[model samples]
Target: MTQTAQLYRMVMEDHVCPYGLKSKDLLERQGFAVDDNHLSSREETDAFKKEHGVDTTPQTFIDGQRIGGHDALKKHFGQDVREEGETTYRPIIAIFSVAALMALALAVGSLGTVLHIRVLEWFIAISMCFLAVQKLQDVESFSTMFLNYDLLARKWVPYGKIYPFGEALAGILMVGGILPFLSVPVALFIGTIGAISVFKAVYIDKRELKCACVGGESNVPLGFVSLTENLMMIVMGLWMGTKAFLL
Candidate 1:
């Protein structure tokens, strides 16, 4: 017996409901014949919503039973669904993963070796820049989240705004192997403060909070991962500073 599903989605001259399309695709993939119903205009969409007593388009029905929206449809099929504000390390993982690959590529291109110390340096520097970029996207939001746990941000306020730019500058300088004098101090100062703040917040204070390491909008928790970021900056600063003194 062939299973049948009905999908009501918005399809206008200037717009198409994305979730509606997703629902249709999912139904077909799951071996169901979808009766695709399109609400072609605002009037029709409103009418459909009123008739169904639903507030949104892209409603699904299986066996003549309402299955809700795309997310709801996924739930019906027992798929993992991510709710808003859920804690996830995806952003940090992606940033570091890409940074590692980039570092390897740079190392191979310049030194013809992937297992060199420079690769690690490049990885850390690239990751720093990427993290800074995330924070810089919305400094106000980042600062707000940062102040929740950062000691310096709580006291100075402006430090939260300045932190991303400082990290970026240090990262750029380190990557270019230029101005060690400036980069070393900036990295060390911010890294030290960050390390101390994260330590106090997560370990000593024992207050669970979202990390501003990725950005204000991130759901990344304040814990080992956040501490690692600060520690990496500190180590990079010290390593480069030592090299500068030696050379």
Candidate 2:
């Protein structure tokens, strides 16, 4: 038998509460019969809020007991409740996941026998370019955030502004397997500086902050993600230098 639920939500002339709609959908999806009690007027909505001691609408009740709002309903159903200002690995995971697929596709399309090292190089380069593009989208915002913990950005203001472009240039050059002299140094120099800065901010100083690795508009925390990016650059840069020297 389907469980029954009552949802009290605001539905006014000007607007209908989206949360209310979502709640109704979620309950029904979970095999619940939802009684959607729409508060058609502001007065009704306000009165309902006052009666239940709730400041918001989209309230849910299950089995004659108040289950609060959408978030509460999710909790009751054993779902991960993600609130605002929460740290998540979604962004970095998405970026790298796509980058890996792209590298694999490129490797498969290659005519000659594709070296494993070359495939790895391509993956790192592509990932760098993708991340750099995100930062370049809002350089001013990225630079401001970068200044909070990046040692080079703090000392040389211009470095922050130039960072995205430099990263992109290095990645692009590396992808084309050209200008190793220029790209290798840029990768090494910036990667080293970034690694040191992240270590100081996160480990040494033990300060919590946002990472500008993706850009200023991102919510990625200043820690593992940032460290991994810098480390990848350092490894790739060193590899490029050694390969060039050996050739």
By TM-score, who's the top model here?
A: 1
- What digit string (tens of lDDT, one per residue) describes model 1 on residues 64-148? 8999999999999999899998989999999999999999999999999997999999999999999999999999999999999
Say which candidate scores most in lDDT.
Answer: 1
Candidate 1 colliding pairs: none
Compose the digit string of candidate 2's lDDT tens values, residues 1-247: 8788999998888999998998999999999998889999999999999999998889999888999888998999999998787877788898899988888778878835455667888889999999999999999999999999999989999999999998999899998889999999999999999999999999999999999999887788999999999999999999998898786
Model 1 lDDT on a 0 to 1 scale: 0.94
Model 2 clash pairs are none
Residue 131 of model 2 has an lDDT of 93
